[model samples]
Each structure stands twice: as C-alpha cells, then as structure tokens.
Target: MVRGRFAPSPSGRMHLGNLFCALLSFLSVKSRGGDWILRIEDLDTARCRPDYARQVEEDLRWLGLAWDQGGSAGGPDAPYFQSRRTAFYEEALGRLREMGLVYPCFCTRAQLHTASAPHREDGLTVYPGTCRGFSPEDIAAREAAGRKGALRLRVPEKSITFTDGHLGEVTEYLPTDCGDFLLRRSDGLFAYQLAVVVDDAAMGVTEVVRGADLLTSTPRQLLLYELLGLPAPEFFHFPLLLSPDGRRLSKRDGDLGLAALREKDSPEEVIGKLAYLAGQNPTAAPRTPGELIEHFRWDTVPRQDIPLPPGLF
Candidate 1:
C-alpha cells in the first residue's frame, strides 16, 4: 500500500498552513487505501517545545486525522522524533562523506550573505559556493585551529529535474539556484535535509506528500539519495494555504491556529471552513473526519494558494 507521513516540527502551534497539510496528507493516503504516519520532527532542539508537540497531536486528532503508525499515537514504527535518530544521521553523513559528496564549509553566515546579496529568487537566500574550493590541508589546518565548519553537499553545476505527481515536471539549477546545502551544522546538529532524507529511508517511507514550499529542495534531496545509493520516494506537493493578504501563512498567524478556534468549540464550523480552504464545496458541514474524507477530491485541490476566509474564526 502507498505509505505517507505528516511530519511537523514542534517549533510552534499548528496554524492554518499546517491544518491544510495535515488534512491533505491524511486524505492523500486514505484516498489510496494507504497508511498515514505521524512523525514529530522535533530535532531542532533549540526551538522544539513539548507542549507544542502535544498540541500538534491533539490538533490532528481534533481534525479527525489518524495515522496507522508512529509517535504517541503508536504504530509499528515507534520513536518518531527526529531527535532520537542521531545515529541514523551520523551513519548517513558518514556515507556521504565516504562518497566524497560532503565537505566541511568554513564560510561564515556573513560571508555567505555577502556573496548571495546580488541574487534573489522566491524571496529566499541562494547559497554561494564560497568554500567549494577548501582543500583537505585547509580543512585540517582549520580543525587544528579549533575552527568548526558546517558540512555542505557539493552540487553539480547542472540542471536537475524531477517529475512531481501534482505539479508535473519541475526543474531548477543547482549551481546558481541551490548551491551547496548544509548537511551538518557547525553547532554539531544535523541539517533538516540530511536528517529527513536519512529518517525517511530508515522508516521505509514510499511516498512524500507535502506543500509546494519544499518543491524547490527536491533536486538537492535527489542528489543525496543518489550519493547514498538509495532510491528517492515519489513526491506530491500541494498548493500552500495563504492568508487573505495573499501571503503564505506562517506560525505568526497564531490567531488562525485550531487551538484558538477550539476556544469557540465550533468543530463543525471549523472543519467546514478548512474543507472550503482546501478547495472543497463543503455543501453540508461534515461533523467527523471520516465524513470529510468521504467528500475529498484530490483532483479538486487547486494548484494555486488557498486564501483563508475573512474572519474565519
């Protein structure tokens, strides 16, 4: 059966953007008679909160999302937190290192920012290969000098392309667009791309269903899979949930979080509004998760951002 997961970071409360992803992931698996897994991506020790994690579970349950495995809800694949998988990251990092795909980058954030200041795409920073030429002796000298560096995966200066089920064929330039991405931070923490690629492989995840915000990172991930001699999972990137102002919703939208809405105790109305935001008619408000799933149409999901309804709460 098709296997998927809803992996959320416990950095903050689940807001409208998160709700859209949760419902989409649940239905994506259910629609195919597949299993949905709930994975807590709480590896960022600096920001993850236990209370926030608890609320994530509660919010999904409130929205009627059930995972067949993982996390507090339980399944065969226990230990869902990424923080618990340090050894896995180390092993993957070792593999990439052995393959000569990963190298230590000594450039500081200030240096990177200065080099990237000239280029702009998607309103995000594009990394420059400032440290791509660091030699082994240079690395050793820096290490001897007690200098710590972030490990970067060198990208080929070529166009990378992949077929996304929802968005069709997608392409991006790795050299000019993506540059070298961090695999392990100087702070001794594994980067998200490195950790996620490793965890998904270890967990036997066959399909990845997430928002389009991550679409641009697929090629870099594909390179990691190739370097590790592993097959990349199929991808489906749905449209992002946007605010009424046409901007993508973020954790800053605390007002739109389910917990805030639950204070009103209008589960029926909340689901109806979320369903509508997901591009469904919601002709009659559905009372349960199962009922909402009954009317879910994967095809009806719009490729463009779904604007939040005005005064939704």
Candidate 2:
C-alpha cells in the first residue's frame, strides 16, 4: 500500500503555505486509498514547543485533514516526534561510523562563512570540508579547547539523480554542491537530512510530498538513504506559496497564518483558496477535502513559485 506523510515542524503557528502542503499530502494519499501519516518534525527542541505542536493538530483537525497514523493517532511506529527518535538517528550514525563515512566537523558558523565554500544558486553556502582531514591530534586539541564538533557524512565525488513527480528528472553533484554535510550538530541534535531519511524508511513511507524549496536538499537525503541501506521514496516537490512581495511565506508573516485566517474565514473557504492557488480547481470556491481529491493532479500544480493573490490574506 502507498504511504505518504506530512511532516511539520512545531516552531510556530501553521501558516497558509503549511496548510496547503498538508491538504495536498492528505489528498494525495486518501484519494488513492492509501494511508496518510502525520509526523511532527520537532527535532529543534530549542524552538519547537508542545503548545505549537498541539495547535498544529487542532488546526489540521479543524481543516478536516486527518491522518491514518502518527501524531495523535497510534501506529506501528510509535513516538512520531523527531525529538523522540534520536536513538534511531544515532544508530544510523553509528553504522556510518562503522563504515568510516562519518567525521567530526569543528567549523563554527563564522569560520564556515569565511571559508572558501561555493555558493548555490539559491544562496546557500556549501560546506568546504575544512575539518575532513583533521587528525586525531587535531581533534583532541579541539576537544581540549572546549570546542565540540558536529558529525558530518563524508560525501563522495559523485552525482545523485532522482525523478521528482512534479519537477521531473533532477540531478545534483555531491562535491560541488554540498560537501560533507552534517549528520549530528555540535548541540547534539540530529540534523534534518539524517533524521528524515531514518524516519521515512522506518515508518515505511513510500512517497514524500513537500515544497520545491527543498528540492536541492533531496540529493543529500538520497545519499543518506544509499549509505544507510534504506529504500528511497518517490518525491514530489510542489511550488512554494510566496508572499505578495514574492518572498516565501513564513511564520513571521503572522497575518497569513491559519490562526489569523480562522478568526475570519471558514475551513472550506481556506481550502478552496489554496486549491485554486495550486491550480487544481477552476475557481476559488469553498470545497471539502474529499471534493478536491478527484481534481488533485500532479501536473496541475504550477512548477514556478506562486505569489499569493492580493487580499487573500
């Protein structure tokens, strides 16, 4: 059976963009008689709060988008929160260590910024592998200096290719793009790339539908899947919902959040507007989750970032 999931971080209130992704993921699985999972990506314990996670569940329930497993619902894979799944990530990291594919990186944010790392088109600074060659003495000296290091996976000089359900074939080179990315941070929290791959594989998720902003990071996750001996899932990266000013919608935009929208609009109206924006509906008329499933076509979703229509907020 096909299994899909919507993993949301509970750092803030659910915004329209987040709801749109959740709705699409729910429809994608439900329409095909598959199971829909809701995983709380609360790996950043410093930012993620219990209240926000509770509100996320309430918001989804209010929107009529329910999941078959995960979140409040119990499944074979218990404890859906990423924070609670650190042991799994540690085990995976241990395996990588056994294979000598993991290394300690002592590069600080300032040091990384000053390093000669290449820049991606999206403006992300690629790691320059400064500490990849650190000897035991160098590591010991750094530790003695009270500088803890993050664990980085040694990415080989090779290319990774995958076909996105919406964006078609996508390819990225490891060395030039992002060299020796982090698996565990100096703060001891598992990085997103490693945690996501381990969780998806363990939960038996066959498909991943998320925003196009993460398209570039998929290659790194694919490498983790290969190294960890996990099955890779199909990916669907839909266009991002941009602000009126063409910026990607974020929690900082309080007015565009679902909590703000709930005070003025009904759930159907919100879903309807997002469906129209996704190009799956002819007009922005209110429709139930089930009603929009028949029209949910991957081809219908726009490939480019969609700017929010004026007054939609």
Candidate 3:
C-alpha cells in the first residue's frame, strides 16, 4: 500500500502555511487510497515542547486532517516522536562508520561562515571540505585545544538525478552542490538529513511530498539512501505558500496561524480556503477534506510560490 507522512517539528503552533502542506498531503494520500502517518519531529528538544506537539495534534484534528497511524495512536511504528528514536539514529551512524564514510569535522559556526567560505543565494555556507583530509595530528591538536567535532559524511563527486512526482526531473552534483554534509552535530544530536531518511525508510514511507524549499536537500538524502542500501522513496517538491508581501509564511506569523484562524473561520471555512489556495477548490467556499478529495489533482497546484492574499488572515 502507498504510504505518506506529515512530520512536523513542533516548535510553535502551526500557521496557515503549515495547513497548506498538511491539507495537500492528506488529500494526495486519500486520493490514492494510501495511509497517512503523522510524526511529530520534536527532535530539537531545546525548542520542541510537549505542549506544542500536543497543540499540533489538536490543530490537525480541528482542521480535519486525520492520520491513519502515528503520533499518540501508534501503529507498527511506535515511538513516532523523533526524540525517542535516538537508538535508530545511532545504528545508522554505526553503519556509516563501518563503511568508513564518516569523519569528524571540528569547524565552528563562525569559521564555517567566514567571508572566504562560499555561500548560496540563500546564505547557506557550502561546506569547504576543510577537515576532509584531516590527519591524526590535526585531530589531536583540535581535541587538545578543547574543540569538539561534528560528524560529516564523506560524499563522492557523483551526480544524483531523480524525477520528482510534481516538479519533474531534478539533478545536483554531490561535491559542490552539497559538500560532505553533517551526520551528527557536535551536540551529539543527529542531523535532519540522516534522521529523516532513516525514519522514512524504516517507517515504509513510499513518497515524500514537501515544499520546494527542501528541493535542494533531496540530493543529499538520495546519496545517504544509496550508501545505506535503503530503497529511496519517490519525491514531490511543491511550491510554498507565501505571505502577501512575498515572504514565505512561518510559525512567527501568529495572525495567520491555525489557532488565530480557527477563531475567525469555521474548520470547513479554513479547509475550503486552503483547498482553493492549493488549486483544488474552484471557489473558497466551505468544504471538508472528504468533499475535495475526489477533485484533488497535483497538476492543478501552482508551479511557483503562491502569494496569499492580504485579506486571507
């Protein structure tokens, strides 16, 4: 059976943009008779609160986006919360170490983001491979000076290409596009790339549908999947929902969040308006998830970032 999931990091209450993703994910899976799993990515223990995760479930329920399994009502995959899944991450890290693909990187944030370091338009500092060739002496010197190291996966120069379910063909070179990315941070927490891939494959996720913001991260994950001998899932990178001024919506926008919206509009009203934004509903009239499932089509969704009307809030 086809399977999909909504893995949200519960740092704050979900906003209008978050609803856009969940509604589409639910509709996409329902249209295909697939199971939907809701996994709370509360791995960042510092920011992810239990109350926020509970609020996430509450908000999803209010919006009528029910999952077949996961979260509190766990199925075959129990312990859906990422915080409780460190052992799995450890095992995967162990495998990478056995394959000799893992190395320690002692670069500090300031050092990595120095003026000489290359950056993408989004200001992501491309890993400079500064420690790729680190000798035992170099490691000893860093440790002696009390500089801890984060684990980095050694990447090949090979090109990775995959056809997205929605965006068509996308390709990226591993070397320059995504340098030896992190496996685990110096704080000993697993990086998102490794954790997400490991969890999805372990949980039997067949397809990954997310915003285009994550489009660049896919190639890095594909490399991990290949190295780990895990079958890569199908991917679909869709457009993001932006604010009226063209900024992408985030948890910071409380006015456009689920809690605030629920106070003003009925659940059906919110769902209907979101469906219209997703290009599923012809008009933003009140409609439930079931009402729009039959009419849902990925082709109808916008190919570019959608700017929400100023009056949406």
TM-score for each predicted model, relative to the true structure: 0.93, 0.98, 0.98
lDDT of 1: 0.80
**Total clashes, candidate 2?**
0
Off by over 4 Å in 2: none
- Per residue, candidate 2 scores C-alpha lDDT tens digits across 104-136 of 999879988874778788888888888989999
State the lDDT at 284 in candidate 3.
87
For candidate 3, write residues 189-233 as lDDT tens digits. 899999999999988998888888898899999999999999899
Each candidate: what lDDT? 0.80, 0.90, 0.89
- Please identify model 1 stretches exceeding 4 Å from their true place: 115-120, 282-284
Instruction: Report lDDT (Cα) of residue 190, candidate 2.
Output: 91
lDDT of 3: 0.89
Number of the candidate with higher lDDT, 2 or 3: 2
- Candidate 2: C-alpha lDDT: 0.90
